[model samples]
Target: MSRRVSDVMTRGSRALPLDATLYDAARIMRDEGIGDVLVTLDGRLCGLVTDRDIVVRGVAERRDARHTPLGEVCSADLVTIGPDDDLDTAARLMREQAVRRLPVVDDEQRPLGIVSLGDLARAGGVDPGVLSGISQAPPNL
Candidate 1:
């Protein structure tokens, strides 16, 4: 009996349109106490934007947060999971993708929730070393 992703995911994750500005995404992250947000186009998941993305891609690049759209800085190369998937699958995907967060989407690619390293940690099944590796600062950073 494996645990489903929905069992440990953070439901009702925040999302914003691709046309939305970085400031909009940052404001939502601040209000929700979340580090990332799903980026959508015409209500379909298209990309993901994170606090690090805002800092490195948006700020560090000198893009005006208020004028720059999320589509411009969001990570379009996404690896999503399904709510019905097992925790092991989530862990494997995160490891293979070297990503700390995964958007849980449906067959239609509409985001349902978000699964993060912290969420997996609280679930108590994934290996701690794997978690540690994911949380480690990148060599270039």
Candidate 2:
């Protein structure tokens, strides 16, 4: 049987507020060694911001980290996964969307956890054929 996404997802993930300062979010990520954080507003999942977002959108833009809010820099139209979804489905979505992380949401759209590419790799459920295909692909080709 295929493993469920929830089985492999990182449960009890930390989240940042949409109105939070970029510097604080970056500090949290650095301290926790997290690549991304879910952006929530009033206890509802609203968007997401990754480490790259801070560099490109905040730093590069010369935006003040102390004043810049997460919502202004986050990707609001986030691609999400359901806890009941299979790992294969999650992987497919990640590949198609070119996103390294996916938020696992409950039926009420409440975030339960997050799944990263590292998690999927560690899960060891990706088919051997798929791994071989990826290996055959050339870098940036």
Candidate 3:
């Protein structure tokens, strides 16, 4: 009797083009009130950039947000969950991957929605420390 990821995921249109700069990604996130956005290549999910990624990778490293492509800042490692997956699966993935957010995809890998620790918490799920670890800024910052 577990809840599906789709039940609590954020269904916002927040995907960005691969050619877009980090500044574009940040602005979209700021306007949309999202931490991360899915990056697309020819309308397909390629990677993702998050607020943490922006601060840690884009800012701390002195990468020029306006010139640095989102694809450059986005983690090359892509991880995802299905819309039908249970929240426990999402939580476990978050814990194991040390990621705060995950893109919800269908079998064909189409972008559906996004699930995050905050979404789970707002949906009455507990953080359980793992989520906090994911959100914490690096010590160097």
Native-vs-model 1 lDDT? 0.90
TM-score per candidate, in order? 0.93, 0.88, 0.82
* lDDT, candidate 1, 1-141, per-residue tens: 999999999999899999999999999999889888999997889999999999999999999999999999999989999999998899888877788889999999999989998999999988888888877735222
Better of 2 and 3 by TM-score: 2
Residue 69 CA error for candidate 3 (Å)? Answer: 1.0
Give me the runs in candidate 3 sitting further than 4 Å from their true place.
125-141
Consecutive 10-residue window with the lowest summed lDDT within model 2: 132-141
Candidate 2 off by > 4 Å? 128-141
Model 3's lDDT to the true fold?
0.81
| Candidate number of the best lDDT | 1
What does candidate 2's lDDT look like per residue over 77-141, in tens digits? Answer: 88899999998988787666666678999887788999877778889988755544444444220
lDDT (CA) for every model shown? 0.90, 0.83, 0.81
Between prediction 1 and prediction 3, which has the larger lDDT?
1
